[model samples]
Target: MIQNSGIGRVLYETLLYLLDNGDEWILIGNPEFLKQLPGKRNTIVASHAPAFHPREFVGFPRRIINSADVFFTPNYNIPGGIRVPIVASILDLVYFDLPEIVRSPVGRWIRRYFARRAVRLSREIITISEFTRERIEYYLKPGVPIHVCYLGITRELRNQRADFLRGPRPYDFPYILYIGNVKRHKNLHVLLEAYLTARKNDFNCKLVIVGKMEGLRTRDAGIMREFAQLEKQGDIITSGYVPDNELYQLMAHTEVLIQPSLYEGFGLPPLEALYLGRPVVLSDIPIFREVYSDLPVTFFDPLSVRQLSAILENHSWETPTSIDTTLKSRELDYAAAAEKIYSVLKKYAG
Candidate 1:
């Protein structure tokens, strides 16, 4: 099990669930992140490979195949030359389908190369949503069994306790939340512009962006400066790399969770907010629509600040919607997701 990503957090929860239910597993990744895993029985093979970069996994195939029964790459990019049943989770084909949105040329090539290999070498494939399933079918060899096992929010986050004494509550007004790394595909500039417009029109609320600054290659730094200017004017709160507890607290108290990602395989934040009983304003993308079709979420165009502003200005907070608890109980639970993954593993292993 190679783990390193936002999705890796979901994988760790799933592995723990599997262990709790009497299935054993090993972890392969940076020792720092894997140290947070629950059980002590599992072995941790320290790997220096950076999660997103494929070059880091250059000679990893033999090492990976030698250790595990079935090799699973949770995010994407399977190590080459492996002699085992490689079970890969292809999160999204966004790199192949939307190359323009990708930050770097190397990132795009790495994704393109490994995605094809994942289809060829894997005995079974997994994806986060049905929308991605179709994309995989179109791009990869036909008839590969691609399972849609949705990612879940951790239970600890659901029952999180907010800190009353935490430093003046971060922002002045209760704000809509946007959580994730600030990447080009995240559409942060558009979100900032929309929030500014909404605030000007007596929306009277702030927008809180919680994530690390990324995408330096695509000149996202200029956009970050613009957001900083907005912050100076008191319309936004830019919390860079917050602790997990604080993130949960922020989600718990947020007026709404808005994710304007241009593309996604399966967005965990909106589902997480839904699980926390917070109102969600998401992009009108197909993946989000498929995952949250039945749920009552406000949708906006990720590319259009005006459309996003309209949704923000016109939202009603009084609707009694339990999307958060419902998703937590029905979809985002680790035990349930682990059961599905374990079942698939058993079927293939047999």
Candidate 2:
């Protein structure tokens, strides 16, 4: 979903969430994407779809329309010509918001074109957050109703495990964890500078960056290069890429989970961290506040290293002032979301 990049964990997690609920669903997409679909009963994968431009879908393949009584694409658009009413999920419009870093101009323009068309073609649009829905309404201005269905965290992520088996941690002791991409908007330089300041002030903690360096454009590449140099200095542990099980282990063990992005659509990683009951430090941004209003966290300005450093210096793995998770662990219901999604799809199904 959304370029097959695991970096967009939300897409994959949404699919997994649906499958785990054991819906009678058949996924239709290019063959390569089949590898990423999670296994669960009553799910079928028809990997006959060949990758093609969305415009090419003016003569959209009929076999796809024949395969399902109704269509629901988690992170993609339905072809314009398909007669069946379809529902598609838009995680965010990062490409529209940050075109230079997110995609090449040609690619960005093409995706925007397809996104616009998808809004026109689909019966309904399911967006991850209210923020994304607002962005879609502002830019695409679709006639279709936009639904705000928050994503669900898997029980695997919420595993109850020990912080450490018992040790001094690694590379000079206890560490804070940062997961996800190092894209320009990620505001990583601030996190690095803050970690450095914390170290200077005798906060005996290493910074662990558990993500791969991405962004292929020239300026984005420079950001990656700088991160590589930071890795060389060994002030932080950049664990290139880790599996989910390992990532879960890391989250369970770290001193705090910090998401320093300047902007985010939903910030799924922090929510997952909070699901695991890990303390989180976030860049004080609207989306983060919107999502984590009740969850306990330390807030810092993404641009201010001093503020980030101060938050880190005082954060604890042990305890926090406020930890109300009713919004996440209980109230924000995924089963309700699934039922709502099914109700919409059923209205279109023959």
Candidate 3:
């Protein structure tokens, strides 16, 4: 069972694809996350595992290889001494790539250790984008097969109605949307600063930040406190951990979805926005360019508030023709991914 976080959702989605196609798999993770899975006969929920904690070795599947043909651990970290054919997803080597962003020494060591183990054990590695694949290859031993499986916007998002009629403002405000945790790498501080600067120039759009407040270190929390003060003064509305229905409605009606993260293996929110036919303003990072270059998304330097403000002030919304096409491509990719995973399991099935 995977823990319920961003990568956890992806892991579960992938597992569902496998099961729907007639494969058996066990989910081992936190109990809260395990409860989210469908109570199907083929699915087995294992004991809870805390985030970043070492995987407990005592349990069913004592010999990892006997437990499953191909063990899949999404978002790095696999149990040590697991002789199974491990297939791990390495999101990004951000801790190593941008060490300045990593705060605690313990966190840094754990990430590095697990990332190295993932490289060593993974027979087939999956990543969200080619840029991240390149990073993994660069940091790890070369020639490890890295598969790029781009995350897709759920079908529910496309069918979502723009219920701007009943919301507090009811089309009274033109708002820019940002949905994600306000962690250090997310660079919410710079985003807030940019929004403030843009508003000074009479940019009449409100900013809506939607995400849970988790992993916000003291420094980031202090910055958020300042933003909260500004929020009281009516600069931004921080809708913390909004329900999906409200989130999709906001995505459907917003002028633009802004993602100014310093790094992302594959940013899902932008793709979610694209699926909703919403225009996107993303950070001018290599990964964003690699994934969204073919699409029409405005890019800005994540480090520079001036650059972000300039882009926000001048951005315009245009419904994308490529959204449906991208969604179709994703469905095909996921099917192929399921097949590939199944093949690996069959090859090593006991």
Best-performing candidate as measured by lDDT: 1
Cα RMSD to native, each candidate? 3.5, 4.2, 3.5
Which is the winner by lDDT between candidate 1 and candidate 2? 1
lDDT of each prediction vs. the true structure?
A: 0.72, 0.68, 0.71
Per-residue lDDT tens digits for candidate 2, residues 171-277, read 44677899877787777777876776776788877778887665422334554565567568765687878877777777766778889897787887776666566
TM-score of each: 0.86, 0.81, 0.85
Query: Could you give candidate 1's per-residue lDDT for residues 1-350 as a string of tens digits?
Result: 33445766777777767656544556667778777767657676777766545555674636646556677667666766777577778878888777977667987887788788778888888887889999999888645688887877675664453332232454546788889876667777777777767877888777787887654233456656766787798677778777666777687678888888888888887876765567888888898888876787877777888888887787743343666566655565667777777777766452
Question: After superposing candidate 1, which stretches have Cα over 4 Å from the reference?
Answer: 1-5, 52-55, 61-64, 161-172, 214-226, 317-320, 328-330, 348-350
What clash pairs does model 1 have? 274-324, 275-324
Candidate 3 accuracy as lDDT: 0.71
Residues 1-350 of candidate 3 have per-residue lDDT tens digits of: 35455776567666656666545666665556555555364554556556566554334344534476677777676766676777778877889888767678888887898788778877878777778888887888745677777766553554443443234542467989888886778887788878877877889888888887665544456656767787797657778876667777788778889898988877877877776667898888888887787777877778898888887777643456556675565442455555665665566566
- TM-score preference between candidates 1 and 3, better one: 1
Q: Sort the candidates on TM-score, descending order.
A: 1, 3, 2
Candidate 2: clashing residue pairs, number: 0
lDDT of 3 at 33: 57
